[model samples]
Target: MIPDNEDRDDNKVYFFFTEKALEAESNGHAIYARVGRLCVNDVGGQRILVNKFSTFLKARLVCSVPGMNGIDTYFDELEDIFLLHTRDHKNPVIFGLFNTTSNIFRGHAICVYHMSSIRAAFNGPYAHKEGPEYHWSLYEGRVPYPRPGSCASKVNGGRYGTTKDYPDDAIRFARSHPLMYQPIKPAHKKPILVKTDGRYNLKQIAVDRVEAEDGQYDVLFIGTDNGIVLKVITIYNQETESMEEVILEELQIFKDPVPIISMEISSKRQQLYIGSASAVAQVRFHQCDMYGSACADCCLARDPYCAWDGISCSRYYPTGTHAKRRFRRQDVRHGNAAQQCFGQQFVGDALDKTEERLAYGIENNSTLLECTPRSLQAKVIWFVQKGRDGRKEEVKTDDRVVKMDLGLLLLRVRKMDAGTYFCQTVEHGFVHTVRKITLEVVDEERVEEMFHKDYEEDGPHKMPCPVQSSIPHGAKPWYKEFLQLIGYSNFQRVEEYCEKVWCTDKKRKKLKMSPSKWKYANPQEKKLRPKAEHYRLPRHTLDS
Candidate 1:
């Protein structure tokens, strides 16, 4: 059943019962509206107005015969005016006024007349004929009998002797005489079917409505009486002649037992909200595989890569089953090997040339040292590469001989002993199994130096240097000293020399610095300042 709240608040409700409303080409345009009613506002409260009928039957009848009586009862005030037949008559004739209250069989009426005769007759005694005299002469010889090929008397283009044959005769006459009148086709509409299973079963499983969520699938959410929510995916089955239902989620929220009154789904979130008699509950399925629900057995049986481990596939498990076995070691090994090979191929190709050169240098200087004993009791042999000798002799350093296990090995590693170490696992038969790795040891000095270099290269220091001083007569002393330091003493040569040196400094700083923020300052900044008297007296003043 649709929740009472859904129906109670008109503002929050949406009705989706037809195909046109969900069509992409229509662009959410409504083709037909409820009769005699207007859609004052859209779901989001936008105001729009549309006319129900463009033509009126009463207006058409009045325009056809100006002084006709009892014509209003057979004419619809809101019907669209389709045809005006004044040219066929000697005077004027009008038709196409549909009745609002009656069906086509009951209230439909039409009239035909000679244009010249109708005008003359209206001016004579016929215009004044009313009351008893008019009633008495209504069935007299003045009343015209239907005839063939005559506008006033034709019924299906044949002579109908009595009024009993009028309806059948008219239908035939309309079909035969296409020019005289044309049939109006009824508008196409979808059928309405109200579901009652949830209420009847006493379980809160009611499908309020079904909506197409694009061309792929139809989303259906059913509410239960016991505060249970079931989200179902429905696909149209042409062969079965019915929708194939797949349950996406079946959630129970009530601690006690309460019937769920209604449910709604958020297409954006793929979340389901279920409203019960007492409380409401929400279930979110983030990162849920929608296609997983369809042919879920295939996902479970055939695809070893995909597993049905969540609530959506939990239904496939037999009652009382709890544990699932782990994948075999052989499968794990194969999968890992394939992943490693793919990673090496892709990653190795894109490595920077400079980085590759550095790596090659490190590898050339490194030496692989195997244990002499080959196998030891309760002890593992680890090899470390110190550096290369001047003569290119490989320098082998034993990292540490430690007891087997990761915890014990980590405890023995000291500051001085840190380096790339490879632990060799040896069995009783003098067999050695090696896994090589390069470990880097970082000390406080190295870390600080790295930080200082980064600061000089990329931090505030690397920004454009501000002008230090402006001298009126001679060059500033600091500018002269800067020129001398850069091997240019003359003022004329200072600008060019300073530019090249500054550019070189910027490039070197960039190369030496890391992208990360520097944690250390330059050691030169820690030097003591010169005496105050040394700054107070200039070289020229001392010479004088």
Candidate 2:
């Protein structure tokens, strides 16, 4: 329940649901979303009404899109409602997920409403139906005393002690007229998020108010019919006074394609728990490592939970310890990687290493060079550095060679095609080198001969081709010892050595003290008096 300020601290109550429209519109019958409120102090009228609510009010909640000819496409079917509490206790933001019931248009929309706006709507003019024709119009006639839906309390200058003391005219007016003239409009007069795609039919939603570097952001975790939870946030552009919705991640929590029934977010623990019919799952608030370890990738992600921490792409906590308040770079508004990661990019391979591969093909056979980008939205760009002068040229598609989604394919492997290939991705105007590969075309007949010669020189475990690296003359590749340790004989030797070592850890002890310090510490009181003086109860005195 959300807080509603009234005369009493615990006097207000709110109810939300979808029901058939009472008044007929153009259509015969259609469901309309509504929010009704009641006051706890209302005691009904003494004469006209015996026992009923005198301060009950209700108004329509609009969630729709403007269509042609002034007709609005309404998402009238209510699916879920989430109240995101803010620092202001009385007025929490309302997030309502709605679906369109029209057969011609199937879509979902998320409408945001504020408590202040809703309160104002209830206090506006009341809708009245009069005359023989019974046309509904704003009641321009005189309103009854003390207002029809006003609560009787000290807040109104102690006007009326209770609804029982009010006149019969005011009490009867509230019973007959409950609808308000002005309906509550959404924040921006439109849905905050609208989806007309076929793959999505939103079911439930949970929102978390987050504090980031720039400002507070409301992150919404909406569950769908396909068992996927969408993590979305709204970015407000100050210059344009507009809101931009960004879907940061789409997590498939269930594999059975079942509907996600419920979702909960723990801001303290930084986790989201999702539950479906057959399964449940939990995920951390931020998966910083998925953004890649480069400063460019981290900044481009536009995730408020992560930032470039000078050394790596790490979780960014705006309320973290002082040590974490370092000058990390995060640009959520623009994701300007060139401005945020220009000279601050890591220099060594430890933090900024790219994926490398060694691909080989026979003299006449075909070969496929594979590349995988970090994001599905990225555009793959290929380049080749075949020139000896150390210049790179863009790889153009041809009859014998072609570029594909994941990589490039060669129809025929020729010795002249041997060179280093660079696979890069361009996304949001930022370029990143994701993969580097060296293409080698060897003779079909001499393949076995080359393997035999390398085996005799470098041992059978070595790679069939000559190893290439810039390692120091006396040192081997960093993984050489690891490769040697996995042999059959060495594995057994390692296992035998491990058997000689045993764990010395004890089960557990809540608290422990050393024997040497026991003498200096206070002695334990093992034996206590059966009846301590202070523990005895006070005796009662006889009274006359």
Winning candidate number (TM-score): 2
Off by over 4 Å in 1: 1-36, 39-215, 286-544
In candidate 1, how many Å is residue 283 off?
0.5
Return the TM-score for each candidate structure. 0.21, 0.70
lDDT of 1 by residue, 316-336 (tens): 212233453221111111112
lDDT of 2 by residue, 1-544 (tens): 4445544723567888898864635335568898888777777789876887877878889998877899898999889998887778888899999999889979999999999888898889998887665656787888888788777767655767888888888888888888888888898777888889777789999998876676677888899998777777777666875667777766766656789899888888998888888877887777777676678877777778888888787887777666666658888767777788878746421335666655656777888887756554567888888858788889888988887754888887888888889998786788878778877566765665655655687676653222335445786433333323234454543332222121111311112433332221111211211322111001111110
Give all candidate RMSDs, comma-separated: 31.7, 17.0
